[model samples]
Target: MSNYSRFSRRRFLTTAAASGIGAVFLKGCLGNPPEPVGTAVTEQVEAAEISPEMMPETTKVVLGYIPIVEAAPLIVAKEKGFFAKYGMTDVEISKQANWASARDNVTIGSEGGGIDGGQWQMPMPHLISEGIITNGNKVPMYLLAQLITQGNGIAIAGKNQGKGLGLDISNAAEFVKNYAKTEGRKFKAAHTFPNVNQDFWIRYWFAAGGVDPDKDIDLLAVPPPETVQGMRNGTMDAFSTGDPWPYRIIAEDIGFMAALTAEIWKFHPEEYLAIRADWVDKNPKATKALLKGLMEAQQWIDGVNNTEAVVSIVAGRNYFNVPEDILVPPYKGDYKMGDGKAEIKDKMMGPLYWKDGIGNVSYPYKSHDLWFLTESMRWGFHKDAISDIDTAKQIIDRVNREDLWKEAATEAGFTADIPASTSRGVEKFFDGKTFDPQNPEAYLNSLEIKNV
Candidate 1:
């Protein structure tokens, strides 16, 4: 924990965007069998060298993470000695002040006194691959894996007295759109960064209901950890982010969850494991080792009877800093909407983790990246260029390392059930919209409100 640093809301930088990422992992996997399970998250595993000569070149590696349950896999990997088991002896988990710091540090890389790899948004790696964002020293990044799927990622109608649920969101969009049209003003909403997955989720939902997110609403950048306080102080009307905050908002009675991103897109890929591309190119084996460890943690997190322990581990002061009780409900699949509505505990709404050692909720899918790139273009990210599928494919092909995760899963014994294809075909949204990865431009044209 020596790598940990204290964060302040005062240090947040603003940018906004995000996207659904990932395809799926194997049906079984491409391996033999996994090792036995450990009890505690901090329990160290007995070291077993993968090969007599294959040792990680870097003994210690620094990774940045926002202190949230979404970052659980990374923390769990370190705590459970998976990193050590996979040859990364000195894995340091550093705390970031906010998404801005995370983006900055990851961009700089360890060579520039920044992070080597960390849990990041799905769209960031795409931005990095396209050179829209870069290391302070100009190093690109690789999207190695999509760590987790969807869970309450988009919860609009959280502000402005909007009904927090149902198909009436069009009304709120109308209200905001009408406000913008008549009064020449915008309703303010909050997000963790200027452009993150949260922002895209917010924008997509608004656009689906006939509102132009860019013009009708003011999207404010509030750090995820502080978003609840921002809402409490009326700094924002609504916001969406990873766990604790969503449930925390409901618990605090400041707002209600409008729509869970899971409901929007049942299997929306939320976060990714990204690192400096140059470092990864130099240390592919080390990168694979880290992926192997994180995959192990992913299996543990979604295993049956493991939610409580995971909640406790991440809720620790060193992690999310939230109390255990607040995390229990979400871990248990009960999302209290806080609008006098019943708790939603559907498995899809819960953290999309590997349950009972079987599930592809965390695989880094090329199709997921493809969808994300399309959304990136729609929101004006390098809109003049790189919006087309060919450019997006080039960036994704260059950055997305689904093959690494597959190799890691195979080596880690997730075998006999590897996904036949890296693409998951066309995925449908709650609004009856479907994104066919092969034809992303069609999906882009299908949308009524977009940047281009």
Candidate 2:
């Protein structure tokens, strides 16, 4: 094991015990599974009590999160008293082992010792609603709000540094295509989960460069730690994952970032905050209360002044369990791309919660949901579930609940930030490909290397 990994594990065990945060073993993951940890809230802030009519049906909730930047808002809401301020005093932020564990846990819901809902990748709510990734048992869900934007990217192994593995790999596409012939194995790559945000990012990057992702490379889902170890041992060549991991690669000299999702599509939609529709329906007031808390946390984290505090709170052993320095660069938008690529130093390039270059990041824009489904179609993922554009639109309409986000924002006195439209309009990617929500079919047809 790498020294960093060993140190992190020791720190996790020591701090988790000292802090009195209950840590449970998580089964079924690569390597030894780290004990599942939850929020250890400190210093509760006093706020005005909710009116009798506005009081939530329930004050408690269990939300799942992976220890990544996308999960900052959820963790912050719990740690900084934002949830309690909004009348959600019993909120629990549970750490998930991996995306698959999250999926399985959510399948059983909170009553069954699982999460009610929490941070999620694009289209997962839709897929779970339609029973695509849920073992064919539909669990209706609502896409409440987007958790974050940017903070994700593609990483290339250090061994492949100078072979045209940057953002635009068109110049060395042949090098990637001929890996099997020369190296005696297919160029291996991985994402956190299949048919999700990370998977889509890598697929788009590969297809844009005239390299067929399916034919030219071996792409599969692997946990982030294993992915990093694979890169170190020269077993994995590339990875598409969220913040901290990508930065860890560069800090440990294991790999260099090929591109940020921010560069892939500036201020692009990343992960989301979604919940079971049954949960939302049963406790509408509580649902709004959760959104209000998340809104406060999101707005708080966006302030440049709070970067250090944000890093400190979320990097605790009970939370992300990563080194503070590893998170500092990405949170400050100070990425060192290595491999002769220019370094990026724009604050907006980091994870943004409430707003970004275009508009409100907290709003669950229906247009962004359309793009995920359209991209899924491009790769022919879950074709039986999302057979066509019309089917995808129906799913989006059912899953995305922008109206609830607006209600929560307005109630929280954030009326000014609510977007006027559900769509963010046409989005342009790094490779010059544009996805127009109005013409998703045209967008799909425009792709040169797709199963569809």
**Evaluated with lDDT, which candidate comes out highest?**
2
lDDT (0-100) at residue 161 of candidate 1?
A: 57
After superposing candidate 2 on the true structure, give the runs of residues whose Cα lies further than 4 Å from its correct spot: 1-22, 28-44
Lowest-sum lDDT 10-residue window in model 1: 11-20
RMSD of each: 10.9, 7.8
The most accurate candidate by TM-score is 2
Model 1 lDDT, residue 251, Cα: 77
Off by over 4 Å in 1: 1-42, 135-137, 155-159, 162-168, 179-185, 355-359
Residues 226-263 of candidate 2: C-alpha lDDT, one tens digit per residue: 99999999999999999998888998999999999898
TM-score of each: 0.85, 0.93
Q: Give the alpha carbon lDDT tens digit for every residue of 223-295 in model 1.
A: 6546666667655566867787777777777777776777777767888889888888888778888988887
Query: What's the lDDT for all of these models?
Result: 0.68, 0.85
